[model samples]
Target: MKLLLSFFLIFPLLLSSQSFEKGEKLFVEGKFNQAQLVLENYLKSNPNHLKTLEYLGDIAGQNKAWDKSISYYKKLENLKPTEANYYFKYGGALAMKSLEVNKIKALGMIGEVRSSFEKAIALNPKHIEARWALIELNLQLPAIVGGSESKAIKYSSELRELSPVDGYLSRGHIEEHFNRNTEAEVQYKRAILIGGSKVCYQTLADFYKNKMKQPDKANKVWEEYKNKNNKGIK
Candidate 1:
């Protein structure tokens, strides 16, 4: 009788652990629907499971179910506000939802994204991806709705300082859009010097030819790019 009681006592724990494990594995395998079902079922009983909430948020974000993702992430934030990743992802989902639906909605999402990113930054100032995303988001907004060329330049410069190779190309876009032609040229050239890309070369060529009215220079750059990439066959 005692042994049977002991087994009964331990069985629920074992079952709960197994459910979490299986749900986690399904999540890792990208079986989000299965994972979500398992996780949701688990949460019905174990409502305070932090990891389950995190995984659900991840699944929802991956599926682009922004509202669901935000709900799960909010639960996570309430549980552990210090964890920067949750905030970053929650903000990202909101930003994506804005883009997927309406700009007005997207504008609201941008505020959430900024707040989350800022919180993440405060928690870990060296968070490179968060910084990059912030810069990208700032650049994407219009001036009338809190977008500022100065802010873009500032964040872009900060990003460049962190990793010049990754940030130069992005900085070039900010410069280009702000009509800072000379700065843009310097940035594009820096990107090329630090192992840029064919696309970068093409962009620079177009800029020189059309915007700067320097066809000869553009042709020279294009010829160099074509020779390097369009080799052997065509």
Candidate 2:
């Protein structure tokens, strides 16, 4: 009787999570419009559901509805202020919005994006993606706008301590940004040899195409990626 009663008590929660699961699956499959519809409808009833808000935020970001993405993520931040990923998403959306506007408008956002990314790192010292964002921002912006290769390398070191894949990937990007193609290729290839992430492979592939002028190498990487992910073959 106790077991049966416990099952009944947990069933509703399971059903709720299943809906969230479906929404997440749709989001992952790039059905952002459908995911937005489902998640938005779900939020109509569960107005403060964090995971649903996350999905809505992701869908909005994917669609380039930057303001809406910021809105959803802000609501989530209000609900749980310390989640590193929330701040990362908020900062990323803010950066995109900044890019869409004029320099004057973007100027105000640059500091905001930097601060939010920093806050994410403060909240989770090992948040690799947040660290990567900071590194990129620091490297991309000019000296007058607070660009600092020194700061970026600091973050890169911290990321390397946390994740080898992202560490080398970040290093490759940094090298590429400064036109250090030889070093960039070496770092990208190193990241690829680690081999858990598709992004690393694509980064190496893009380097071959864009920097080395090697489409054949790029195609080979793409084929390798497809082969690893495809399941229809023997």
Candidate 3:
């Protein structure tokens, strides 16, 4: 009787495990709609399952269902208050939602969006993406509303200390945004020299083609990258 009772009690857990593993596999394979169906069914039985909620939140975000994404991430943040990533995802969802809403509503959400990112940074002092987000936010917002080049540069400087490539790229981005093409070009070149990665090369090439109107330079940049990569220079 005791053995039968133990098996009965463990059966549901085994089923749940199989269900979630299938759902996670589907999610990893990018069959998000199918994964969502399976995961939602599992969630009905395991409502507070953290990985299930996280995968659902990611799928919702991928589908551009920002409100639903925010709801899941908010629950995650509440459940795991010390987890930096949950706060970051919650803030990212809020930021996307803000973009979809009216200007007044977006303005209303700004404080919370900023706070969530800040909270993530507080929890993880070395959070690179959070710093980048703050840099962009400061640069994009109107000066009257709180935008400041100095603030953007502050984050860029921090990035420099963390990763030289990101620092130069971000500084270049800021300069490009301010219409300082020459300064931007200098920064981008520095990044390519230091990193020589695909993104670094692409960033400089795009700047040359689009911003500086130099298609020949862009082509040359691509060719250079191909040649250097073939030679195993980077």
Candidate 4:
């Protein structure tokens, strides 16, 4: 009778563990809908599960349900105050929500969004995405409000110190925004030479096609990328 009671006690815990693993696997496979069902069920039993909350937050974000995403991430922030990424995600959701709202509301949200990203950086100096968010945020906001090319450059400088590729790409983006096409092209080329990643190649190609209005140059860039990859396959 004691043995039967122990099995009954342990079985539910084992089942919950399996359910959690299955939910994580579904999330990784990009089956967000299925993952949500599994994770939501798991969360009912494990209310304080951090990873489950994060996955649910990510799924909500993927669905563009910004309010739901923000709620989950806020809970995460409250539960795990020390984690830099929770702050970042909370800030990102706020930023995206700002876009859907009116300008006045967005202006109101700017402080919180900036502070969240700032908090992430304060917690983890090496947090790349938080720095990138700041760079874009600074660039996108109008000068009348708070935008500053100098501030964007400051983040770009930090990115350069951490990752040269991101630094060059971001600098190129800033230069392109300012219509300094030659300088932007130089930065993009340097990024290509240094990073040689798909993003680097695509950024340059899109710049050529759209910004520079040189389709032939874009085609040539793609050809070069294809040739390089083909050689690696050989």
Each prediction's whole-model lDDT (CA) = 0.82, 0.87, 0.94, 0.95
Residue-by-residue lDDT tens digits, candidate 3, 32-117: 99999999999999998999999999999999999999999999998999998899899999999999999999989988888898
By lDDT, who's the top model here? 4
Please name the candidate that would achieve the greatest TM-score relative to the true structure.
4
On the 0 to 100 scale, the lDDT of residue 178 in model 1 is 72
Can you list the residue pairs that collide in candidate 4? none
Task: Give per-residue lDDT, candidate 1, residue 44.
Answer: 88
Which of candidates 3 and 4 reaches a greater lDDT? Answer: 4
For candidate 4, what's the RMSD?
Answer: 1.3
CA displacement after TM-score superposition, residue 228 of candidate 2 (Å): 11
What is the lDDT for 50 in model 2?
Answer: 94
> How much is the lDDT of residue 147 in candidate 4?
84
Worst 10 residues of 3 by lDDT: 139-148
Taking the candidates one at a time, how many backbone clashes does each contain? 1, 0, 0, 0
Give me candidate 1's TM-score against the actual structure. 0.73
Name model 4 segments beyond 4 Å from true. none
How does residue 134 of candidate 1 score in lDDT? 77
Put down candidate 4 lDDT per residue, 114-228, tens digits, no spaces. Answer: 9999999999999999999999999999988788899999999999999999999999999998999999999999999999988999999999999999999999999999999
